[model samples]
Target chain A: MKRILAADIGGTTCKLGVFTPDLELLDKWEIPTDTTDEGSRILEDIHQSFKSKGDDHELNLAGVIGIGLGVPGPVDFNNGILNGAINLNWMEQKPIVSEFESISGIRTIVDNDANVAALGEQFKGAGSGHKDVVMVTLGTGVGGGVVSNSMLIHGHGGAAGEIGHLYVDYNRRFQCNCGKKGCLETVASATGMKNLAVHYYESGMTDTLLKNGIEAGTLSAKSIVEAGEKDDALALKVIDEVAHYIAVALSSLSAVTNPKYFILGGGVSRAGRMLTDRIEAYYRPITFPPAYENTEIVMAELGNDAGIYGAARLVKQFLA
Target chain B: MKRILAADIGGTTCKLGVFTPDLELLDKWEIPTDTTDEGSRILEDIHQSFKSKGDDHELNLAGVIGIGLGVPGPVDFNNGILNGAINLNWMEQKPIVSEFESISGIRTIVDNDANVAALGEQFKGAGSGHKDVVMVTLGTGVGGGVVSNSMLIHGHGGAAGEIGHLYVDYNRRFQCNCGKKGCLETVASATGMKNLAVHYYESGMTDTLLKNGIEAGTLSAKSIVEAGEKDDALALKVIDEVAHYIAVALSSLSAVTNPKYFILGGGVSRAGRMLTDRIEAYYRPITFPPAYENTEIVMAELGNDAGIYGAARLVKQFLA
Candidate 1:
């Protein structure tokens, strides 16, 4: 059985995993990724972890195959570089794959982190049995990855499936982290939810959330969901709108990448049926005729493990 | 260079072409498509065309390699069946590839005509050197196709790349052919232009177009552009707004796909730099940082040839 090392690099943390041929997670570990301090150090840390872990396995495979690293930000996959990470102080283009290969003596592959999560989910989570899928990650921002016909859709610069930027409302523009406004991330994301909560609560409406010491200030989308599940009027208003926004994005996405399964991942997705149920309700009615019945939305199954599994799967396809 | 048969099936016309491996066009023809009377007759007609072409040259290489047909509607690529073609009155699913293959004694392939156009642009048109691209067909209605990493992304059941149905407004909704309202199609499509023009023409805005039979039922997006080029007030207002709306859709697609190039095709795109210049002017300033300098919006070169070229390209990739 070929054992491969999968690494998922993020702005906050780096995940390392060793998986068997059948995708069994044999071992895993996490490391703080302060890409701000020294970006090269993070790459070294990854090498050190690989050396320490692979020695423990002492397992051998054909040429050690390839390592798949899913990084955050716009990446030039052909050049093997992480162009820049806004969260990280990575202004200078860094050659990630070659840097790792110089020390590890193994080939490497890469894609955007959100895309990797989708791949991971397809390989180990809710989309396990599905061949084509679109996964939305609602973390600090809304991210998306698409797999069609058993392959990842990485656009020109490995930034394909960046769903955060899809326009939700062209008429009433809303500012986004990308400096552009009215993007899907401006509404359907955790940050988006919190923003709406503040806007609504500030609009003056008595709700259980405010009475129970819940304020949009110092609150998150997660908190809003929590409040909504407990029947908070304000939270309900915010979430219903968010669900509708997500449905709009979903229908839009379905139009572009007609997939049977729409996988919802990331932190906010933990709300489960709370999000899915609302999304489905809104998604079906507004979607174009044939698309309504042809697509399905489901929560991601792998949880945090998706990144590792997806990284591993990347190796399987590329290394082979 | 191997020779391949390519066909583009549309609502008003069916385009057939014989292409060489270098993606050079050797010969082309056209036929009106209304298969409601007899579906199978279309195949026989195509077969007769092939026979007239006299494929006495090296037509059969290994497998004689399938004909490529681009139909105007949803399609099941894996099964090579036309899921449904609303334009052609193809009510039931038709095995397009098998039908063509059996008649011509060569394997055949099929996909949504828009996707084929995208493939054509990527392979031999304005996006010739590009690997990842999004092609928007701006005719009476808006249609889209996305290609990532050198592969055309056809999502579950070939639902991927339907950008026209994406929602543009959350509050001021405009009904779309897809049953959803505020779709980009409602504002960006040529049909949408008529909607916008009708509103403007009826609102007491006197102009050359209205004076020159625009209100007398001689108005289309084409007439609008011709008038706009001459600085017609109503035409300028309508075309500029359409250009901006199209720009917004481009930004949305860029945010998601991040393709290196956006190939603008179909009838409306013939507006030339008038359309592209307007989009580029507004798109760069309005989109996120990552998109500002990365993607390019160019007119498609394949034009009518995209359908046939794309079909051949699809079959060629599978063979390669």
Candidate 2:
């Protein structure tokens, strides 16, 4: 009758889940993430909310086995510390594990948000049944999580799965936030897609809805993708270009880890087949032959719930 | 005391070693690889050599716990099968582990040569004391092995760590044996270096000892790297270009699985500090910042013996 608690902390919101030891979500909710005082109050806020939730559910807090946190930053998993979360305004190392454990009196595990999402997908979503998975999350920016042999590959400095920063566009046409030109993020992230659309439109290939979106100051990755789905020329071109860059990154990733499944997640991934089809087409001819023959491109199935599921699963895995 | 047997099976020679369970090498030797008849006799030949070595050294073959084989191809590790090895004319699936086990009456474990070599380096060479390591072997061709969290990452199809095939040189200038254009192997291998020398020379940059070597058919990756050490113009340029591509590949690798150390081995690595220093210089400016700061590029310490050491380590790890 043991229970588990999980949290996926992001820039704006924190998703919380209460689950049975078997990982069945009993209840889930969200709360605003307060960035005041550099997120110093975040852990206390989370603890209060969990306490209230347990009370409301008539749940015994003592039955909770542990809590897992998916934070928006690199994590020193061994120490359960957030390296730095710029998005959360926690720009210095935060001892999340010890603080959370002390407040909740429960064991805690912490990992990068993207990595946990990948674990979630691998455990019960797109990557279900696959031991090796690469999940690329295309939200405001691009992020990735690599699972090899069913374990997250936290690189030397917890920078293992930064797929977005993979150098892809050798022409260096676009600059990434990471101070690198030609990164996959420069062309495939949501903003990167918008930028590509603008680049294409300004380069005299302007016969599309993106032009309207641009002049109206309504240009966004979603609109561009919708236009592309509707066969808008410039938007489709941008999709093609984005898919190409994504495929390039996947090809390189294949050569490196050769995961069985490359799961596309986040808002942009809702493009689904429209994006996966293009990626597979471009990926087939370019990726390492063995990887091409063995690996599959899939869509994320858990949607927004992936983070919470991943977080809970992290606790389950750690306990196991 | 329990003992272990290890073999590194290559195209020309098979290096064999005997080690105590403590991994202390008791003896080592080599024999010509009988690659005749599609390599059908390979297991018997290895067994014969091991038996002879045991007799000569008064070794108790009965005390050997297991034998580990490092083969020159993709492996189905779970099945203990060589998927295929073209260099040894092993073009079809071969159940190496079972066959060797049957021949030698010793349990067997098998892995790709590059993978075991990486494990070797990680266990006791340049990667000693590091849990995550990436080893790049710049031999006649470029090969790589990636170890993460103290385990080799053998992707879905055992095609993980195929770093030589990483897509580089967006220009698609050179063709790789894998039928790809602009792979890391197309520019960073020993032959790749020679080809770069040829490309540079043909493009009218011919003002070095490389020209004389080229004219004399003595142009080698070694000669070019050595000449680069003495500041030969064309040779230095080729070295710079090779180092650039290697750095680019490393940067991408760092973004993927930022290992603690990049162990450079094989003949091309014999260029020593001249090659590593340039690689580091170029690598520092391009790699993911965390990786650049945390990962160190070092020369392989085990050299030709790495394969045998790695092979033995494989048995050790498998038994553990």
Candidate 3:
């Protein structure tokens, strides 16, 4: 059995796991990440942790296949290099797979976490047997991964699934962090939700936020969504507006990509089908007719571990 | 050398070409179509033409590798059935390839003309040798084709690459025949351009069309664009509005597909670089950075002949 050491490297924490070929999770661990400067130190910590585990089980001495990693932000999957991951504040021409292989004495494969997670969802999660699937991870920013004909759709420069940056309106103007205006991210992402709330507060729809001093500083998107769940009048108003834009994005995506399965993931997707239901409610009636009946929308099933599982799958595909 | 008979069925005319394995244009013929009854008679006409040609050549004609057809509508490429073609009035299902083969005694493959044209552009036209490409055809209604990783991306049931029907605004309540509102097709196609001009005229735009009595429904999209080229005020306003929506569709498609080549085709694309340049001007600013820098947007080279070229290529691939 080929064993893979899969790791998902986020900004604040790094999660790792040892898994068999069949995705049998044998062992798991996590460590606080020092992502700001000297990121290679994290590699040393992982090696030390492996050595400690090796002394206990002699698993490495027995032999293992390889390692896999899923990094945040844009990645050059074909090259296994750190292309440009904003969440990790990493800007490296570093050969990630080569570095990891040098440290662990095993082959390694790496890809963007969103793409890895999408593969995991397709292989063992909500996507199941579906071949064409699009997974949208809603976090601070919107992250997307597209799988078509049983292959991940990472286009030239690994920009294929960057649906977050798509613009809903070309005639109007609004600022986006990717140095664009009127991007779907400007209205449909977590930051976009906050932006909408700010707009609402400005428009005097703040009976709830005014009562709770959320006025002076930026509020977490989670807090705002939670408030809406509790029927906060202002939060509900902002969410409705955001939901419509989300529907527009989804409808547009469906028209272009036409994936059979549209899976929603990450912390924000835990808002469950409520947001998705609203999104579909608005999406179905507005898009071309066939899409309304055919496409399936569901919340992700694998949760946080999807990245690790997908990373392992990449390791198997690349290393084998 | 494997030879394939490639056919492109348009609204007003049908074009036929016999191509060699190397995509050499061996022979060509054209015939005006009679679409009084859902286009079944057109297929019979094509089959009879092939039979007469075969008899004249004194050939046994059993091993005609494959026949590839390019239909003028949103076709379910996987199923080889068509839907949503307004001019043809084909509301019901028709087995285009099978019916043709049954009559002509040739194995056949069929896809929407736009999808085939994308293949033509990618394999033999402007986007030749590009692994990632998206092609748009701007005729009666807008149509699109997607090629990724050197493979045509036809989703389950062949519902992929239907970009024209995408909605940019959920709140937009404009009437589309598909019962949708504010679809990209509503503003991005030749018909859409004419519609925008009418909207402009109705909303009291400066008069130039009134001088030609175009308000009486005599103005074609081509006529309006011609007027715009002469610096006519109302035509430029309507064309610019149409260009903005085309940019919206392009930005959204680019974000998800991240194609290396974006090629524009169809009858309206004859407006040439005028429409393409304007689209790029609008999309360049709004596009997500890094992507905009990498992706190339250009006019399609194949034009009306793209479908036949694409048909030959697709059929050749199947034989290969």
Candidates by TM-score, descending order: 2, 1, 3
Q: Tell me the interface RMSD of every candidate, in Å.
A: 1.9, 1.1, 1.4
Task: Give TM-score values for chain A, per-prediction.
Answer: 0.91, 0.94, 0.89
Each candidate's DockQ = 0.61, 0.74, 0.64
Q: What TM-score does model 1 achieve against the real structure? A: 0.91
Scored by lDDT, model 2 comes in at 0.87
> Which sections of candidate 3 miss by over 4 Å?
A18-28, A31-37, A43-67, A86-89, A101-107, A169-174, A315-319, B22-25, B31-64, B82-91, B96-106, B169-173
Off by over 4 Å in 2: A55-59, A206-208, A215-217, B55-62, B206-208, B212-218, B226-232
Better of 1 and 2 by DockQ: 2
On DockQ, the leading prediction is: 2
Ten residues in sequence with the least summed lDDT for candidate 2 chain B: B53-62
lDDT of 3 by residue, A1-320 (tens): 44677888888888888887677788888877776575757766766676677644446724667778888867777788877666566665667878877877878888888998998898778888878888888877788788887778887767888878877644344577887777777777777777777777777776785335466675877887788889888777767766777777778777777778888886666776557778878878777766546788888998888888888877777775
| Residue-level lDDT tens digits of model 3 in B1-320 | 35678889888888888776577777778877778876658888877776566643332346467878888766776666776566666667777767777787888888887788889889889888778899887887778889887678887557678878877534463566667778877777877777777777777784774346464667788888788899889888877777777877778888888888888876777877677788888888777776667888778887778889888888887753
Q: Who wins the TM-score comparison? A: 2
Any residue pairs clashing in model 2, and if so which?
A: none
lDDT of 3 at B290: 62
Sort order, lDDT high to low: 2, 1, 3
